[model samples]
Target chain A: MTGSLVVVGLGPGNPDQMTPEAAAAVGSAEDFFGYFPYLDRLSLRPNQRRHASDNREELARAREALAMAAEGGKVCVVSGGDPGVFAMAAAVCEAIEDGPEQWRGIDISVVPGITAMLAVAARVGAPLGHDFCAISLSTNLKPWEIIEKRLIAAAEAGFVMAFYNPISKARPHQLSEALDLLRRHLPPDVPVVFGRAAGRPDEVIRTVALKDASADMADMATCIIVGSCETRTIERDGKSPLVYSPRSYRGGSI
Target chain B: MTGSLVVVGLGPGNPDQMTPEAAAAVGSAEDFFGYFPYLDRLSLRPNQRRHASDNREELARAREALAMAAEGGKVCVVSGGDPGVFAMAAAVCEAIEDGPEQWRGIDISVVPGITAMLAVAARVGAPLGHDFCAISLSTNLKPWEIIEKRLIAAAEAGFVMAFYNPISKARPHQLSEALDLLRRHLPPDVPVVFGRAAGRPDEVIRTVALKDASADMADMATCIIVGSCETRTIERDGKSPLVYSPRSYRGGSI
Candidate 1:
């Protein structure tokens, strides 16, 4: 059999959000590689084997999948959200660039899925309907100064923002510091959304003002969306309120 | 009979990219409302009615769907990519806020789909693996000044940028002007991916240097992704080259 490697996204946590292409890729693979939680999301066939690793072992996971595929095994690498968004796709590519020369010939393709930010945006109306930026707050690979600079620039540019890995036990003060920086630039009434486990059964989506946002409101599975100056919320009698940023922007100072 | 409305994304164009949740929402709806091209992507059942309209008539289309749902019909409003990303979800919410009071009571939900940027990013090997921003280059709704300011800020902030609605017949010069603005700040060899009809059968993804890119390479169906300073490309022996941005930044001057 010809060796092949396909990176697929399982989507947030909902089976219904998984695309047919991703599901088909998983079904046809002889070996699956991913983080423990994402690997658990897939149901292995009788003949398939799974390789589950920790979250910090992305490079190791990519090497394992590449090695298996080079030995003529059909391998699938999975990520919770779209693999291309700060996930396995980049890790796989990085491995191929640095691995053995023969490993370059292996067939590789990335199947897209619904990412967390967009899922959260859908759930909370369209806070990202206008121009927006996505920044990961984890300082594991990059410095906190870089994240701070991007946050400040994004705010000054009037782009609505989505922050991934906003808060975790390892770093408790970053999210609050980021929000404090935004509060200095953005309006006090700007809408902020905390989406935890979006698209899952126990999904929680709350829209708060920038003045009321706290770092403790988010965890690893959460995506925090901060709206632009134009973002607004519509009040409903008995239904959940809707929040969105209008596509048009009137003249304003940045 | 109770009424309901769902705004769903159809992914880029490939049926395999459509999520099961969005497919089910379309399957169960009595009325389908969308742009002519998007509505054409869906197959109607025997009792389902398709309401296809022009692209510029988003508000009118939202009103029509709301009116139908208010009269006890299950309505599905569809957009090509994720409905919440520069699509119909915001329009529907706007209509609900501005329209008759009775429309607010209609059950509405937004089902997320794979957006064009993520689909294109997957095809091009994760240029968005790091911090990124997405901006619509269309000056139809917003002013060219704001777009220019955003381009400058994003470039200054070292963000991988995705440009949606890059070029159209009416605004032929906006993309070139935008590229020219970026040329002033970014390096000349930065990789730029022009992905047209991203996941569709006729999908075309081409990577060119910042200096070699032109306006005619894109249409409304295209999403232009510009790499950050850290983005790199790997040459293959006999296959197409792969492009990606590394997750690490090694102390670069912004």
Candidate 2:
């Protein structure tokens, strides 16, 4: 039998948010590979096995999964949120490209899921209803200067910005620096939404203005969305305000 | 009977790709409002009613849905992809913000789904593996100059770009103009993916180098992804090449 390797996203953290195709991929695989937390979400059958690893060991996990699939084992790699967005799908493709020739020919399919940014955006009104860009705050792969440049460009271009991996125990200052940079370009009233563990039981979605947003509002689980000048907020009586960027933009200062 | 308005996404025409939460929302709502084509995707029960409207009538659709929900009817507004991303969620929110006082009090929830860009990114390799921005080429709601400015900024910042509503019968020249702008800043070998109706039965995923990409390759249904400078393609013997942008980027000249 020619075993195939399928990389699937488990959505953000909710079972209800997981796509049926992704859930089916998780069910069909005999072996699973991912970081421990993501793999922990899956309730596997007795015949299946899981190979869990450290958080940042994406390449090693991908290589091991590819090797097993090459040996005709049905392998599945799980990722939180969409696998293609700063996740394991790239690592798996990287492994296939650099590995043995047989690995290239192995069947590989990437199943997309509801990414965190989308989940977070849903909780808010529609901050991403306008044009937007997603940037990871972690400097593990790219330089901080590149992040700074992208932030400036996104702000100046009037694109609403979503920041992933915003702050962790290791890097706590990047979110603050990012906000500081945005405050210089965007209007003070621009909404900033900090969505922590969005869609889960402990989901906390908070919206603050650009002038008041700070690093402490976000954690590693949090995805921060900073709106453009055209973004607006609707205040409801005894309800959390709805924030969204309007679809129409007449140059700047809307 | 207090009513609620839930805006749900029907993931790029694939039922299996729809999340259980969105499916649940669709099931619970009695009245559905959306563009006719998007509403046509739903296999509603006998009791469920669909209020189909024209394509450009977003505000009218939102107001009608909100009005129905305010009258103690469970209403659902459907969009093709994620509702918050350039879809009906913003329209709904805009209606509420600008509409009557009671519309604000109606319980509203936005359910997320697998967007076309995510589905397209999954079909190919992870071209959106790093920092990325989504731009809509249709100049219906926004100015052409804003789109032009974003395209240039996204290119300068080295963001993998996803273009939604790439081309239509009306706006045929925007995609070509967008590509011409990218060619000025990006490397010629950068991969451009044209994923038309991704995840649907007639899904077509095609890739070309930036130099060879044209507006003719795309249609209104296509979502075009232009890779950053770091995007790479791995050629297989007979199958289509896998295109991905490495998570790691060493500033410039990767």
How far in Å is the alpha carbon of B100 misplaced in model 2? 1.2
Across residues B37-83, which tens digit of lDDT does each residue of candidate 1 receive? 99998888889998999997888999999999999999999999999
The TM-score of predicted model 2 comes to 0.98
Q: Please write out the lDDT profile of model 2 over residues B193-240, one tens digit for every residue.
A: 999988888999999999999999998889999999888999988778
TM-score of chain A of each: 0.97, 0.97
Cα miss at B119, model 2 (Å)?
0.2
In model 1, the runs with Cα more than 4 Å from the true position are none
What's the residue-level lDDT of B156 in candidate 1?
88
What is candidate 1's DockQ? 0.84
Best by the lDDT measure: 2
Model 2's DockQ score: 0.89
Q: Which stretches of candidate 2 lie over 4 Å from their true place?
A: none
TM-score of 1: 0.98
Tell me candidate 1's interface RMSD: 0.9
